[model samples]
Target: MANLSLDSDELLLPRDVVAVDVPASWGGEVSHQLTFAGPLGPILALPGRRTRWLFLARWDTRPHTPPPDVRYWRDRVPAPTAHWVVRPGDALPLVSVIRCAIRTVRP
Candidate 1:
């Protein structure tokens, strides 16, 4: 489990609640992993892919604090690999974030 510590009012989403779906081919199955960070949400990565996606959850309610910005994510997420944030819901944001991350990393 993640060593994430949250305040009493903050939402600590379960593995299922924040789960993200990715291409099966990327890892032989669609799996989710939580990246321990601030309010930036979960991180998704594939072994061969040069880019990773940072998913943003709605928290199902208003949070005591606002979510972190992209700069915060870029600075904290792992280096060498590119990262992008994907807001919860439909496939559009997922695809768009993937494309954007690819574009940013491909040079």
Candidate 2:
């Protein structure tokens, strides 16, 4: 597992999971991108607004290669990957997303 420190919270993520800054064009309002080297593919997390943040997960059987310059491989990527919008002040949804990513990793 990898230790990811966000503010005062530290998240244990899969060792192959990597987070990078998301470009304004692709991220829209998000701050970072989480790329899993597994079937889970990429999971984009938007910055928290006054009430909530968004978590977008994409499933792909093929390996994920992060686009150069923080751009997505294709513009249409977001359309099909718009999977979930976590409710305000809810950490459970985020946990679930993390779990899914973790599960995709192979020992």
Candidate 3:
């Protein structure tokens, strides 16, 4: 099992969500099993590849706090809360996708 932290300033706001594109193989298996961890606890497991967009957000408990939302590639999607880790699995490599996305964002 892998552990991810969601206590970063970048994820403090409700709208601060990260969108990760999870690619699947022809067999419908993913290269990794992701686990998201928030300040409270584990948010949710990777929902099967219904949508290529893996939306992520930070867990907020403020009253009436709006949910996390993102606009990627001209599409808007709701995001789940927290940090994530990629576990070993069979299929396409998702870590590379995530790393690439992060790299594009920072510097």
Candidate 4:
């Protein structure tokens, strides 16, 4: 993926959520991580392949809390998915929205 350049209309400050459109056959390893600031802290996404374009979700990490049940989301979210391990706080709603968007497109 390349830089996410956005037009004036697409720009959203603070929670600057951007979408990177990638081909379906992309299998290259995610050598670099693109992170954005969420409500809590830094949020990162590793996009995975889907039927057409790739999809991404903000994953939060909680050191004190038990690890998230990623196994369940792995299948549903698709391959090459990006996750941001963060404290369970404001990121929850963003993650939920990302998951819901992914679910809507999946078969």
Stretch of 10 with least lDDT, candidate 2: 83-92
Candidate with best TM-score: 2
RMSD of 1: 14.9
Error of 4 at 95 (Å): 1.7
lDDT ranking from best to worst? 2, 1, 4, 3
> Worst lDDT window (10 residues) for model 4?
27-36
- The alpha-carbon deviation from the true structure for residue 23 of candidate 1, after best TM-score superposition, in angstroms, is 3.6
What would the per-residue lDDT of candidate 4 be over residues 63-101, giving only the tens digit for each residue?
Answer: 222112222232132224344333223333334443333
Put down candidate 2 lDDT per residue, 4-79, tens digits, no spaces. Answer: 2232223223333333324334432232222332223233343332222223332233444443443222212222
- Supply every candidate's count of residue pairs whose N, Cα or C atoms clash at under 3 angstroms: 0, 0, 0, 8
lDDT tens per residue, model 1, 8-64: 323233332332233323321111222112223434442235333334332232223
Error of 1 at 46 (Å): 4.2
Q: Which stretches of candidate 4 lie over 4 Å from their true place?
A: 1-93
Candidate 2 has an lDDT of 0.31
Clashes of 4: 8
Candidate 4, pairs of clashing residues? 46-82, 48-79, 48-80, 59-84, 60-85, 60-86, 61-85, 61-86
Clashing pairs in 3: none
lDDT for 12 (candidate 2): 26
